[model samples]
Target: MEASEPLSGTCHCGSVAFEVSRPAFMVACNCSICRRYAALWVHAPPASARIVEGEGQTDTYIWGDEQIEFHSCKSCRAVTHWTGVDGARWAVNMRMVDPADLEGLPVRHFDGADSWEFLD
Candidate 1:
C-alpha cells in the first residue's frame, strides 16, 4: 500500500508478465508444499492479476480438496503463485517481485496445512 505504487514481475522466459498496483500484504503459508516452496504470497483479486502472455505454458497441480490451482512455468518449473477455485483472486509469488518495489512489506505465516478449514 506504499503510496499506492505499482510493481512489475515476470517469469524467467519473460513470456508471462504481471503488475501490482501497490505493495501487497505478504503471507507465508506453513502448508507442506508452501513451506517446501518457501514462497511469500501476495493475495489480490484475480482481475489484478494479468497474464500478459504464456497462457498455454502454465501448468496446474491439484491436491487435497483441489482448491488452489498452483500455476508454474512448464519449462523452468518456476511457480507463479495460484489462482482461486473460481478465479476470484490470485496469490502471487513474492520472489517474482522487484526488491526495490517491495520495501517495508510485512510477511505473515499461516498454518494452512494444519487448519481444519484448509485440511481435511
Candidate 2:
C-alpha cells in the first residue's frame, strides 16, 4: 500500500471499525497482555484515527496503571484499539488490518514485559 493511503480495519464480527493513516511504523509488544492479544499497534494522534463504526458496541478493559483503555468488539471479542486515559494519544490494532495492506511497514518489537524498551 502507498504510504499516504489509509489503513482501515474491522473486528472479526465487523462490529467495530476504524481507519488510520498509514503509520510510519508499527509496534509489536511482548508484554503479558499484549502478547496474549497479539496486537500490532500503530499509534497516531487522536484526530488522526477515526472510529468509523460501532461507536457504542465495544467493551473496554483497563489494567495495570490504567493509563490506557483497550476496546474490543463485544460480539467477537476481538481487540480493536486503545486510547490513552488522558485522551491525547490513541492507537489501533494493526493485526485487524489486511496483511496485504501492511506489506512493507517497519515493525518495532517492544519489551513491555520488563524493561519497557524497544527490543529492536
Candidate 3:
C-alpha cells in the first residue's frame, strides 16, 4: 500500500471498522496479549485514526499498567485495535486489514516480552 493512502480494516465480523494511513512498516510485538493475538501493530498518532463504525459493539481489555486499551469486536471476539489511555498513540491490528493492503510492508520484531526493545 502507498504511504499516502489510507488502509481500511474491520473485525472478523465487520463489527469494528477503521481506517489508517498506510505505514511504512509494522511491528510484531512479543508481549503476552499481542503474542496471543498475533497482531501486526501499525502505530500512529491517535488523531490519525478513525473508528468508522461499531463503537458500542466493541469491548476493551486493559491490563498491567492500563496505559493502553485493546479493543475487540464483541460479536467476533477479534482484536481489532488499541489506543493509549492518554490519547497519544494508536495501534491498528494489521491482521484485521486486507492482505492486499499490506503488500510490501516489512514486519519489525519487537521484544516486548523482555526489554521492550526492537529485536531487529
Candidate 4:
C-alpha cells in the first residue's frame, strides 16, 4: 500500500483485472452517473493501465456527449474503469482497488455535477 508499490485490482467475479501505479490521491465525483454508481476515481494515463484479463468479457457504456467510455465487467456487473474516446486519459474505479492500497491517500471531492471543478 506504500506510494512506491504498484496497484492491482479486479472485478467481483474476476472478469476484469487491471494495474496502475499507486495513486497519490483519488477523487470522489458527484456527477449524476458517478453518484448513481458511487464510484471513487483514480486518474492515470491510458498507457499506464493495462487490462490483465477478460478483455472480451467487459462491456462499455457511453452517454451524454460520449467523450468518455465507462467499462464494466460483464460477469459481475462491477464498474471497473473508464477511458477517453481518444485514448488519451483514463480512470480506474477506486472501489475495486484494495482498501489497504488506499490508506493515506487523499480523497478530494469534485463538483462534477454543477461546476465540473474540484471542491477542495
Candidate 5:
C-alpha cells in the first residue's frame, strides 16, 4: 500500500465536501447497490477522512445489512460515500472524486457479490 494523501471529493451538486487520505484500499464490488451506484470504493479508515461541508444537505441510505450507511447529497442525490459503523471507516465513492486525484492509484476487485454468504 502507498502512503495516504488527502484527496478531495464532492457531491454532484457540489454541496457536500469530503477529504479522504489515500493508500486507501480501493475496491470494486459486484453487489446490487454497488452496481446501481456505479461506484469505485476506497475503504479509508476514519482518521483518513473528513467531512468538509454540507453535513445538513447530506442524507443517509440504510440498506439490507445496515452495517454501513451510504451518504448522498440531499439536493442532487449524488452518492458520495458510505461510513462503516463504530467509526471504522469512510467507504468513499470514487466517482465523486477528482480524476486527477485518482492518478496512479490501483483498484482491487472484491467479491462482495457473494458477501451475503462469505461475510455472513
Candidate 6:
C-alpha cells in the first residue's frame, strides 16, 4: 500500500469493514478481554476512522467498567474494534487489517491486566 493510502480491514467473512489512516503504532493489551480476543489495536480519533461497510451491523459487547464497547462481526464473530462510551475515542483491530500493511509496525505492550501502563 502507498504511504498516502489508508489502512483497510475486514472481518473474517467480510461482513464488517473499515479504513483509517496508518496509526503511529499499535497496542497489545493483556487485559482479560483483550487476552482472549488477541486483537492488535490501532487507536485513532473517533472521527478519523471510517466504517465503510456494515455500519450498525455488529454485535456489541460491554463488560467490566463498561467504559468501552467492543464491536464484532455478527456473522463471522470477529472482534473488529472498541469505542469509548462517550464516543471520544475508538480503536480498530489491526489483526483484521491486511498483514502486508502491518509489516514493521510497532506494537506496544500494555499492562491493562494490572498497572494499566505500557510495559515497553
Best by lDDT: 6
Q: How much lDDT does each candidate structure score?
A: 0.73, 0.89, 0.87, 0.85, 0.78, 0.90
Arrange candidates, best TM-score first: 6, 2, 4, 3, 5, 1
The RMSD (Cα, Å) of candidate 5 is: 3.7
Q: Encode model 6's per-residue lDDT on 1-120: one tens digit a residue.
A: 787678999999998999988877889999999999999998877326788999898999999999999999999999999989988889999999989888987999999999999998
Query: How does candidate 6 score on lDDT?
Result: 0.90
Clashing pairs in 2: none
**lDDT of each residue in 23-117, candidate 2, tens digit only:** 87899999988999999998876327899999889899998999999999999999999889998898899989999898888999999999989
Ranking by lDDT: 6, 2, 3, 4, 5, 1
> Which of 1 and 5 is the better model by TM-score?
5
Worst 10 residues of 6 by lDDT: 42-51
Worst 10 contiguous positions by lDDT, candidate 5: 111-120
Q: Using lDDT as the measure, name the better of candidate 1 and candidate 2.
A: 2
Candidate 3 TM-score to native: 0.92
Measure candidate 3: CA RMSD.
1.7
Give the residue spans of candidate 4 off by over 4 A: none
TM-score per candidate: 0.82, 0.93, 0.92, 0.92, 0.82, 0.95
